[model samples]
Target: MAYQIFFREYFQTPPLTRAYTTACFLTSLAVHLDILSPYRLYFHPTLIMENLQLWRLITPFFYFGDFSLNYLFSMLFTYRCCRMLEEESFRGRPADFLYLIILGCVIALFFAWFLLLPFLGQSLTTMFVYIWARRNPYVQMGFFGLFVFRAPYLPWVMVALSVLFDGDLETELIGILIGHAYFYFEDVFPYVPGGWRLLATPRIFKLLFDGELENSDYHPPAEERPAGFNLGAQEEQANQQQRNEEN
Candidate 1:
C-alpha cells in the first residue's frame, strides 16, 4: 500500500510509467540489437541504432539530452508548453496532454524512421512539427538572452537558426510541433473531450484574463466590467503617463 502510494505520486502518468518506460525499453532493445547486428539477425536500420522505428514511439516524449544543461532546458521548455496547454485547453485533462504529445511523437517518429531516414538521411518531420506548432498565434515562449518573443513564432525562429547554425536540436524542435497540433485539433474538432482541450482553454483564459486585468484601456462593458472605476479613462491615463515617462 505504501509503495503504491509512493509510485502514484512520483511516477504518476504520461511519460512517468507509460512513455518513459517504453522509451527506456526501446533504447535498451536498440543497444542489444546493435550488438547482435554483425550476426545478420536484426534489421539493418535498427542496427544503426539511430532513432529506430520502435524508439520512435517514445523517444520524442523522453529527454533526449543526458547532460545537465540540455536536459534542464528541454525540461523547462517542455514543462512550460505542457503547463500552457493544461491551463488553456478545455478538452484536455492532464493525461490527455501527455497522450497527444506521446501520440504525436510516435506518429512523427514513425514517419521519420520508416519513411524518411531510409531515404532522407534523418527524421526531419519531428523537427518540422515543432516549428509549425510553436508558430501558433496564441503561444509565446518567454524571454531569451536579449530578445523576448511571443510563443507561437518562437519555434520557427529557432528552426531558422538551426538551419543557419546547423545544430542537431531538431528532435526537440519536432516535439514542440507535435505538442501544438495535438492541442489544435483537439480543440477544433474534439472527438475526445477529456484530452488536449483541458490544457488549452483555462490556460489561455488565464493569459487573456491576466492581460485584460493589466490593461486599463480595454474596458469591459458597463454591465460586464469588474467592480472598479471607468476602465477606459484609466487605461488612457496610464498610457499617457507611460509615454510621458518615455520622453
Candidate 2:
C-alpha cells in the first residue's frame, strides 16, 4: 500500500514519460549488472541492415552510454523535460506526442546512417530539451540553482556546456538540427502564406491514442498563432472543447 502510494505520486500520470524513463533506468541497470552490454545496445546501421539486428534501431534511443555520473545527469534531464512536454504542450494528446517520437526516431536513424554515430539516446534527450525550450520560450530555467535564463536559450546553453565539459558535440548538434527542423515545419511554416502544417498527426494515431481530434490543427487561425509557441497550438482549443463537452 505504501509502495503503491509512493509510485502513484512519483510516477503518476504522463504515462509515456513514465514508460520511457523507466526503460532508460532499467536498461542502465541491466548494463551495470552485466546482464546486457552496451555493445549490443548501440545503433549500428550495418549490423541492422546486413545482420538483421533490428533491435539496435530502438535500443540506442533508450541508452545513454555506460552507467555513470554523466548517465545520471542525462537521465534526470530527459525525465524532467519529457514529462513537462507531455504534461503541458502534449496534454491530452498522447497520440500526437507518440507521432513526434516516431518521427524523431526515424530522422535520428537517417542521420546515424550517414554519420555512423553509434549511440543516440542522449541525442534524443537533447532534442526533447530543444523542443520544450522552444515551446516555453518565456519560462525561466535555473541551472543547479546557480543562474537563470529564459527558456529558448536552454538548448544552446546545453550545447555550450557540453563543449565546455569535453562532452561529445556531435550528438547535441544532431539533436538541435532535428528539433529545429521539426519546429519549423510544425509551428512556424504553417503560418506562412500558402503553407500548411507539414506533419499533421495521422487519423490512425488519433484512433489509437486520441480517439478524437482527427485533424486537430490543419491550420490554426491568425489570432491564435501568437500564443501557439508557448501554450501549444491546440491546447487552448482542446481545453475549450472539453469545457464545452462538460457544459
Candidate 3:
C-alpha cells in the first residue's frame, strides 16, 4: 500500500492532491498498525538519547501521538491544507513544492541541533498554511458530528490553546516557526520591494517575516483588490458625494 501510494502514476500530478493522499494513507496505516503510539516517543525521550540518526528527519512526521478525535482532526486538517496549496499553481510547481519540503526539513534540523529543541512534527506547519491562506471566514467544517462556522481567528486560537495546554507538545509549536519561514521565504520574499537581501540571508527568518520590513512592504494595496474598485461600489460612493455637494 505504501509503495502504491508513493509510486503510483495516478498520484503524480497536482501537488496538493499528492500530498493529501500520502498523508491520508500514512494516517490510515498508522491507525491500523497501532504503531502510532510508540512512534511519538521520538520527540521525547528516545530523541534525546545519544547517537541520534538521520532517519529522524521523517520520523516526527509519522507521530500520530494518539488515535483519538483530536489526532483525526489534525489529519483531516492537514489534508485540507494540502488540497488548498495543490490547487494553487505556484505551489504546484515541482521545483517550488520540493523547495518547500526541503525548506521545512532544514528548519527542523536547525532547531534540533543548535537549540536542543524537541522536533515538532508537521501538524503545526499544516495548520499554519491553512490559517495564512484563510482570507474567507465563512467556511465550515463538521466537528464531532456537528457543523460549525469557521472562525477567522481559529489559527491564532489554536496557537494560544497549544501554548496554554500543550506543554508536552514542544515540537508542534517550534515546528510552526519553521513552517512560517518556509512559506515566507518561498512565496512572500520574492514580491517584497527590496528583499534581494533574502537571497543572501535566506535562512534568517526573523528579517523576512517579522516587522522589520513594514516600511518597505510591497504587497498589493487595498484599493487594488477586485472587490475594492468594482464599478458598483465606486459609482455609488461617487453619486452619494455628488448629492451631498449639491445640498
Candidate 4:
C-alpha cells in the first residue's frame, strides 16, 4: 500500500522537473556504480569538437560526483528549485518554463566551453536556485539554522558557502552570471519604457507543451444544469416546473 502511494506521488511530480532530477540522480548513480567514469562526462571542448564526443555537452550538467553529504544537499536543492519554479512561478506555462531551461542551458554551455570548466552539475543547480530566488524575493530561508535571509540573497549566500567550504567559486559564479542575464531579459526588460520582450517563449513551444486539459463530454448534474453563460442553459429539465405550470 505504501509503495503504491509512493509511486503515485512520484509520477505526479511536475513532468519537466521529474525528468531533470531523475536524470541527475541516474547519472550520479551510474558513476557510483563504476558503469560510467567522470573522464567521459566532464566538459572538454577538444574531445567534443574533434572526436565527435557530443555526450560531453550533456553529461557534465548531470554528474556531480560520488555520493556524499554535499551531493545529497545539492540534489535536494536542485529538485526544490525546479519543482517550485514549475508549480508556482511558471505555473500553467510549461512551454515558457521549457524555454527558460533551454535558454539557461545554452548560456551555461557557452560559458563552460569558453572557460574550460570540467563539470557544471553544481553550476546548473545554482542557476536554477538563482532564478527561483529572484522570482520569489520575499520568501525567507534559513542557512544551517545559523542565519535567515530573504530569497533574493540566496544565490550569493550559496556562493559564499562554496568559497568557505570548498574554496572554489568559479562554477557558482558562472551560474550567477547566466541566471542574472536570463532574469533581466525575461522579467525586467519587458516592463521598461521603450523596451520589448526579447525572451518571449516561442509560439511552437506553446503549441507543443502548453495544451490545456478539458473534458468536453462532461455533463453538469441536474441541479446545476440550468445555470450557464449561454441561453441554452435555461432549457427546462424534467425535474423543473414546466412553463405552462407558471402563473
Using TM-score as the measure, which candidate wins? 2
Top candidate by lDDT: 2
Runs of candidate 4 with Cα error greater than 4 angstroms are: 1-8, 212-247
User: Using Cα atoms with residue i matched to residue i, what is each candidate's TM-score against the true structure?
Assistant: 0.43, 0.85, 0.55, 0.81
Error of 4 at 34 (Å): 0.5
Q: Write the per-residue lDDT of candidate 4 for residues 115-152, one digit (tens) a residue.
A: 88888877777888998887665467998899999887
Query: What lDDT is obtained when candidate 2 is compared to the true structure?
Result: 0.81
Local accuracy of candidate 2 as per-residue lDDT tens digits, 69-188: 677778877988999989977888898889888888889888988998887877888889988887666566788898999888888887887787666689888888888888888878
Q: How far in Å is the alpha carbon of 173 misplaced in model 1?
A: 5.7
RMSD of each: 12.3, 6.7, 9.8, 13.2
Q: Between the candidate structures 2 and 4, which one is better when assessed by TM-score?
A: 2
Off by over 4 Å in 3: 1-52, 89-91, 114-119, 123-152, 160-169, 186-188, 197-247
**Weakest ten-residue segment in model 3 by summed lDDT:** 220-229
Clash-forming residue pairs, model 3: 16-86, 120-171
Whole-model Cα lDDT of every candidate shown, in order: 0.42, 0.81, 0.50, 0.77
| Backbone clash count for every predicted candidate, in the order shown | 35, 0, 2, 0
lDDT of 1 by residue, 106-168 (tens): 555554565442211112233333433432343334556767665556566555644654444
Error of 3 at 192 (Å): 3.6
